[model samples]
Each structure stands twice: as C-alpha cells, then as structure tokens.
Target chain A: MATILKVEGLWKNFGGLTAVSDYFLELPEGEIYGLIGPNGAGKTTVFNLISGVLKPSKGRILFQGIDITWFRPDQIAALGLTRTFQNLRLFPSLTVEMNLRIAYHTHARSGFLAALLSTPSFFREEKEIGQKVDRILELFEMSDFREEIASSLPYGWQRKLDIARALVCEPQVLLLDEPSAGMNTKEAEDLAVLIRRIHEEFRLTMMVVEHRMPFVMGLASRIQVLDYGSVIAFGTPEEIRNNQKVIEAYLGVGDLIA
Target chain B: MKQGIRAEWYFLLGGLLLFGGAFLATQFLNRYLLYILVLMGIYSIATVSLNLTNGYAGLFSLGHAAFMAIGAYTSTLLTFPLALREAYELPMLPAFLGGPNFVWPFFPAICMGGVLASVAALLIGAPVLRLRGHYLSVASLGFVVIVTTLAKTMKGLTRGPMGISAIPSYTNIYWTYLWLLITVYVIWRIVNSRFGRAMMALREDETAAQVLGVYPMKYKLMSFVVGAFFAGVAGGLYAHFTKAIRPFEFSFFLTFQIVVMLILGGMGTTAGPIVGAVSLLTLRYALKPLEEHLKIYGLIEIIYAVLLIVVMLFKPEGLVGQKRGVKKITVGGKSSA
Candidate 1:
C-alpha cells in the first residue's frame, strides 16, 4: 500500500526546550498506527505538527504525495486530513448536528453569496449536508442527541462526538489525540471497538496518540514508543511490548512492561 | 413543511405591523414622532450590522462608526447634486468626482458607499483581525479614532471642521424601513446557513473550527466586510436623512451607542439588536422633554447606563438571550447521560 502520510526528521522547539526532535513516521493507506509515550514525550505535539496547528522546526510532512509541511490547518483539512484535540474542543453551544455540519464546511461547495440568496444550489447543498449529518449521527448512534448542545453531552458522548466531528469532514487521514484519556476501562474498551469499526467502515489511515496501553495495543497494528521527544522503538505491538528500551522508557528497568 | 408554514405566518404578521406603522407615520403621528421612527429604523440597521461581527462572529469590533463614516462620505460625494458640487468649493474633488453636470442616483450611490466601506474593511481586517480579544478591540477602536482624525484634517474632501450641509433628504420612513427589512433578511439568511454556522464555530472555539477545516481568516474577514458594508449603508441613510454629514457625528459616541443597543437587545440573535435599537431610541426620545424640563442635560445617558448595569447583573445574555435548555431534545430524550 502507498504511504498516506510521510513525516521525516520532525523537530519542534519551544523557546529553549525541545518539544520534539528527529521524529519520523510513515503511515500506509488504511493502516492504524499508534503513538505512545510518557507525559512529556511530545505525542500531541507530533499530532499538532502533522495537522498544521504548529510549524515543525525541522521536518517534512507529505500527505498523499503532497508536501503539506507549511499548509495552514484549514488547508491541511481541506486536503483530507482532520484531527481531534486531547482536551474536548467542541463548539460548545452548537447542537450536535450543527457541529458536524461545521466540520462538513470544507466539503460543502456553497459560498457566502449563495447563503445570502438562498439559491436553489444552496438549498441543494444544505439538504445534502443535512443528509450527511443524519447518516453520521445514525452511524454513531447519536441520532437521539442530534439536537443536544455539544457542551451538554455526557463526557463519554462528547468524546465520541469529537471523533464523529472529525469523521464528518470525510478525511482520508484522522489524527486522534489522547482519545481515551478520561474514559474508564470499559468505556475505553468500547471506544477501541468503535474505532476498529470506523477503521473497517471508512478504510481510513489513522494515527492515534494514546496513553492507554490495552486500547492502543488492541486497536493499532503497529506502535511507536517515544521518550524525551525521540522514538525509542517502532515495531508491531508485540515487539514494542517486549523491547528493552521501550519497556525501560515506560516503566524503568526491571519493571513489568504492561 | 411545518417550519415553512410558521415562517410564512411570521412574514404575514411582520408585514401587517410594518404597514400599520408606516400608516401611523404618514397619517396619525406628528412630524417629530415620524422623525424619531426614522431614526429608530436607521439605528436598527446600524445595530443589526454591528451584531454580525460582535454578536455572531465574536469579533468585538469598535470601528463600525469608521466604516459608516466612509460610507457616509462616499455616498455624500457621489450624490451631492452636481449643482451643489460647484457651490461647495471642494478643492480636492478630482475631475472624475467634481466633473460638471453629473449626480449619481440614490440606490447605486448608497451601494457604492457600502462597497467602499467593505473595501476599507478588507484592507484593515486583513492585518488587524490577526489579533485576538482585547488587542483586536483596541485596534478597531484606534481605527475609529484615525478615521475621525482624517475627516477632521481632510479639508478638501470633507470641508474639515465645517463639515458639509445641504445634503438632499433622500431617506424617509419607506426607504429606512426597506433597508431595515433587507438587512434583517440578508443577515437572517446568513446566520441560518453553513457560512453562519462556520462563524459561530469560530466564535465558540477557533482552534477547533480550524481543525475542522474552517479557515479562520476567510470567515472572519467575510463577516467583518459584510458587517462594514451594511454599516456603510446605514451611514449613507443617516447622511441623507439628517440632510448633513459631519465627521464628529460618526465618532466613538455613535459607535458606543450602537454597541449599547446590541448589548441591550442581545447578541447572536437576529431580533435582539432591533429590539435594542427600538427600546433605547424610544427611551432617548421620551426623556428629551423631561431633561429639558428639569434642565438636566445628561439624564438620558444616565438612565441608559443604569439600565445596562441592571441588565448585566441579572440577564447578561441580553433580553432575547437564547435559553440554553429550550431546544426540544425529545427523541426519547431521557435526560442527558
């Protein structure tokens, strides 16, 4: 399979401190890749760099053969990559459906003039968006909460909604940042299953930045472990689990890896 | 289908109310009352236009008066009656502007005024909009001050402190209300669509919106330019109606009053700003006689300040604030999890 995303020698420096240095990733189309690290390992920073939220100090990122290293966030998304925040970053006051629709903006073809005039083409595109929103909601089993304000949703549901929002843009690549951070084991397990289902359903290339061991191990085919902004190991989940450096990076020497 | 019917009914009701109001203005109401109504309509346009930026897009701009001033000046120059142009001694009127025997019609001139204001907005917004929150507010306020200073010093174009008088009275009850309806309709259409939703998304959380593929600059600049366009239109109407154009009139005080109307009515809702304009304008007119009777010149503003404080304390969302819990969430909606 062709590489959907290629990150080469990525580095991010925040003032005097290096947040990320010489990080590399090559995610194949339709592959599920996991990034796991300790508190300051710069997992979220890598996601930010790929999604164009922050510029890399030194790196190149190619999305589907296009160099998107310097693209703006919206431009990156328009080229079919979307990301979710580690902290819930939903449009709090917007309804669930509207939240999805706003994400659907890049795909929608109507402009300000069409909106102002309410032209037939505008109505057609709006109906299409409504239908797309309905399908996404139903797929997520969030049809019941379609009218609920995003902020008012329960914690688990809000997380689901955030993922759903990213998916609505029909992105070829999805970056999920600490998606299971606040979830209990059972909730995280359910999320893992939902993500697997989404992967199969959409055939997407996904990069998950996670701290949950079982969740990432069960969902991702390959895992990369980071310590102090440098990759310690990159292999299949089983190899990464037993790697001496990764185990030491996560639990220190002589400690159980899992 | 049901929503369509309800909307039609609303249109009918609004039309009836408008007709009756126009009737009263033309027949029953005294000239002073009619004048107040016209002023009310003009202020409503200005307030509604400002709401598109401050209320919906979450850009707290204070330069609306500057855009209006641009519109006012642009339209005034275009429609200044060619005969009067020769009489005014406009030293800086280039051949194209001060050319003999030519006066543009009202509609195009007003539109040109709005276009020019929007152009100005585009020029200013491209850089100024990059700043967020209080910084953006201060930048916009500085823009208003700069425009006022330019109006004061641009003696050839604006006649400096002397200002310009003898402007034709092209605005009336009908013209003012027509523009109000158009403004409301355009903004309402915008707010209910994808463009407006993207704006609200930015307002709620810009970072999230950007990740979702909303280019923040595009939406921000679009809202700012659109808002400035209508504000310019309002300026043109004010210039024509008042039969005078003055730099001092389109200063911070005017912007403050429009901002007050937006807050008092409610931000983010279509009806809020209009209600605010009507309520505040009515109070100002009503208190005019009382202030004169008691010889307390600043009583009107004092009352306004008190009302604003009380509203802020009790209903910070303004009068027409959207109720958070009001949407019908009952698709077997057994409380949120």
Candidate 2:
C-alpha cells in the first residue's frame, strides 16, 4: 500500500517551550496506526499539526506526496485528511443528520446560483445527499435519532457521530484523537470493534492518538510510542509491549507486566 | 404525501393571516397608525436580516446600519433628479451620478440599492469574516464608524450631515408589508435549506464545521451579503416613507435597536426578529408622548438597556427560542393523532 500521510522532522514551539520536536511518522494506506503516550506527551498536538490547525515551526508534512505544511485546516480537510477533536466538537444545535450533511458540503454539487434558482438539478442533488446521509446514519445505527440534536446525544453516541461526520467527508485518512477517552469499558470495546470494522469497510488509513492501551493494542496494526514530543518506539503491538524503551516510557523497565 | 400537505397548509394559512391583518390595518387605522405599521414592517425586515448573520451564522456584526445608510443614499440619489436638487441649493453630487432628468423607477432603484449594499458587504466581509466572536463584532462596529464619517465628511456627495430632504413618498403601508412578506418568505426558505444547516453547524462548532468541509469564511460572507441586501431594501423603503435621507438615521443606536429586537424575540428562530421588531416598535411609539412630556430625551435608550439586561438575566435564549425539552413530533404522529 502507498503511504497516505508522512510527517518528517516536525517541530512546533510555544515561546520558549518546544511542544513537538523532530517528530516523524508515515501512515500507509489501509492500516490502523496508533500513537500512544502519557499525559502532555503531545498526542493531541500531533493531531492538530497533521490537520493544519497549527503550523510546524520546522520540517515537512506530506499528504499523498503533496506538501501541506502551510495549508489551512479547511484546505487540509478538502484534500481528504480529516480529524475529530478529543473533547467532542460536534455541532450541538444541529440534528444528527444535519451534522453529517454539513460534512458532505464539499461533495454536494449545488452552488449558490443553484440554490438561488432552486432548479430541478439542485433538488435532485439535494435528494441524493439526503439519501447518502441516511445511509451513513443507518450504518452507525443512528437513523432513529437522525432528527435529534447532536449535543443531546449520550457520550458514546456522540463519539460515534463524530466518526460518522468524518466519514461523510469521504476522507482518505481519519485522525481520531482519543476515540474512547471518556467511555466505559463496554463502550470502549464496542468502539474498538467499530473502528476495525470501519477501517476494513472503507479501506481507510487511520491514525489514532489514544492513551488506552488495550483499545490501541486491539485495533492498531502498528503502534508508535511518543515520549517528550518524540517517537520513542515504532513496532508491532507485541514488539512494542516487550520493548525496553516503551516499557521505560510508560512504566519503569523493571515494572513491565511480563 | 400527507406531510407535504400539512407543511404547505400551515404556510398558506400563516401567510393569509398576515396579509389579512395588514389589509385590515390599512383600511381601518389612522394615517399615523398606518405610518407606524410601515415602520414596523421595515424594521422587521432589517431585524430578520441581522439575525441571518448575528444569530444563525454566529457572526456578531454591529454594522448593519452602515449597509442601510448605503442603500438609503444610493436610492435617494438615484431617484431624486439633479434639477430639483440644484433648485433647492443642495450640495452638488458627482458628475456621473448627477444630472437633471435622471430618474430610475422606484422599485428598480430600491433593488439597486440592495445590490449596492450587498456589494459593500462582500468587500467588507472578505476581511471582516477572518475575525471571530467579539473581534468580528468590533471590526463591524468600526466599519459603521467609518461609513458614518464618510457620510459626514463627503460634503459633495452626501451633503455633509445636512441630509437630503423631499425624497419622493413612494412607500405606503401596502408596499411596505408586501416587501416584508417577501423578506420573511425568503428568509424562512433559506433557514430551512442545506445552506442554513451548514451555517448553524458553524455556529455550533467552528472546528467541526471546517472538518466537515463546510468552509466557515464562505458561509459567513454569504450570510453577511444576504443580510446587507435586505437591510438595504428596508433602508430604501424607510427613506421613501420618511421623505428624507440622513446619515444619522443609520447610527449605532439603530443597530443596537435591531440587536435588541433579535434578542427579545429569540435568536436563530424564524419568528424571533419579526416579533421583536414589532413589539419594540410598538412600545417605542406608545412611550413617545410620555418621553416628551417628562423631557427625558434619553428615556428610550434607558428602557431598551433595561429590557436587554432583564432578558439576559432571566431569559438568555429570548422569548421564542426552541424549547429544550420538547420532542419534535413527526408527520406520522400528527397524522395518526
């Protein structure tokens, strides 16, 4: 598979503090990659950098071999790289269907003139988009609550809706920031299953930043460990479990589970 | 099929009721009452337009009055012949814009004014939409100040604060309400459209909106331009009805008043701005004599301020906000019932 996202020698700073330094990772297409670290390990910061919310102080980010180091968030999104926030940034006032429909805006064919004229073509396109929204909602088992306000949904459902929204963009790569951060174990397990199913179903490249060890281990085909804003370990889940650096970064080497 | 019928029936009934009420008011009310109703109709259009930006798009613009001023001046100049203007010793306007016997039809001139205001909004929105929240609000307020200053300083064009008078009285209760009907219908349709849904999404979460591929700058500019267009139309009608055009007419106070109307009725709701504008305009007209009698020239301002504070304290969502706990009843349920 081709590399969908490549980050090399990425550096970001805040005044005197370097938030992310010399970070590097490449996510190949059709695989689940995990970024695991403790608190303030720059996991979310890495996601923000990839999504173009923050510019890199130094180095390059290439999406499909195109340099997107200085692109705006929307520009990056239009290029089929999308992300969800760790804290659930779903549009609260909009319904679940609306939340997904809004994401399909770039795909929708109706321009301002089409809307102004309310032409037959505009209505046809609108009906098609509506059907697409319905299908996505049904896939997530959220069709029943399509008209309900997104903010009113339960926490677990909100997370699912967030992923559904990202899916509406028809992204090549989906960056999920702690998809199971606030979920119960059952919810977390369910989410892991959903993530794997979606990865396979859509043939998508996914990079998830998560602190939950079991969730990441269960879903990620490859795991990259971060410590102090740098990739400390890169290997399979089993290899990462036994690596001395990974053990030391999470727990002392002597305190490893095995 | 039944759902479509119900929706269409509701719309038709509501429209008919509004038209009947307007017709009755024109037939039975005194001239002063008719004039006040016309003002309310114009203000309803302006307030609804403002809600499209400040309420729906999450942009807090306070420069609506500036767009209104642009419309008022543009239409006034277009319709008022230079021969009459010169005979009255009015300050000379630009050579290209000025000339004896120049007179566009009233309706087309009003539309031209709206287009001119929309163009101004596009120019301003390109830079202004980059800022968010309070930053946007302040930038728009600055725009109003700039426009006011231009009107005050550009003596040759705008007559330097002396204001143009004897504007043709082409706006009547019927025309005002007809335009109001059109404004409300257009906005109602827009608010229910996919574009409106995207705007609401941006208001809910900017980051999420961008990730969803809903370009924030594009939606914000569209809302701003559309809002300014309606405001311009309102301003044109206002100028013709009042039979005068002045820069001070579209002041910060006017913008504040419209904001109050939106807040009072309910932000982000179809009926909110209309209810707010009509109620507040009625209250102002009712209290005018008392204000004059008490020699409290600023009483209106004090009352508005107090009302806004009270609303903020007790009902922050305003009067017509979507009820939080109420479940939306679908067509099936209604039909079964």
User: Which candidate gets the maximum DockQ versus the true structure?
Assistant: 1
Which ranges of candidate 1 are over 4 A from the true structure?
A: A255-258, B1-20, B91-98, B325-337
Superposed model 2: Cα runs more than 4 Å off = A253-258, B1-21, B89-100, B292-297, B323-337
Q: Report candidate 2's interface RMSD in Å.
A: 10.3
CAPRI class assigned to model 2: acceptable
Candidate 2 local lDDT, residue B172:
85
Per residue, candidate 2 scores C-alpha lDDT tens digits across A102-219 of 8887777676666654566766777777888888888889999888987677767888999999998899999998888777789899889888888888888999988789999988
lDDT of 2 by residue, B1-337 (tens): 1132255457768778878998999789898998898999999999999999989998999999999998888888788765687765554445665445557778988998899999999999999999988999999999999888898888767887888888888998778877787777666656656688778888888888877677788888889999999999999999999988777878898899999999999999888999999989898999999999999998988998999999988988888887542334321211110
Q: Score the docking of each candidate (DockQ).
A: 0.42, 0.29
Worst 10 residues of 2 chain A by lDDT: A111-120
> Judged by TM-score, which candidate is best?
1
TM-score of each: 0.94, 0.92
Clash pairs detected, candidate 1: none
Estimate the overall C-alpha local distance difference test score of candidate 1.
0.88
lDDT of 1 by residue, A1-258 (tens): 899999999999999989999999999999999999888898889999999999999999999999999999999999999999887798888789889988898888887787776677877888788888898898889999998988778778888999999999999999999888677789899899899999999998899988888899998999999889989899999999889888778777774434
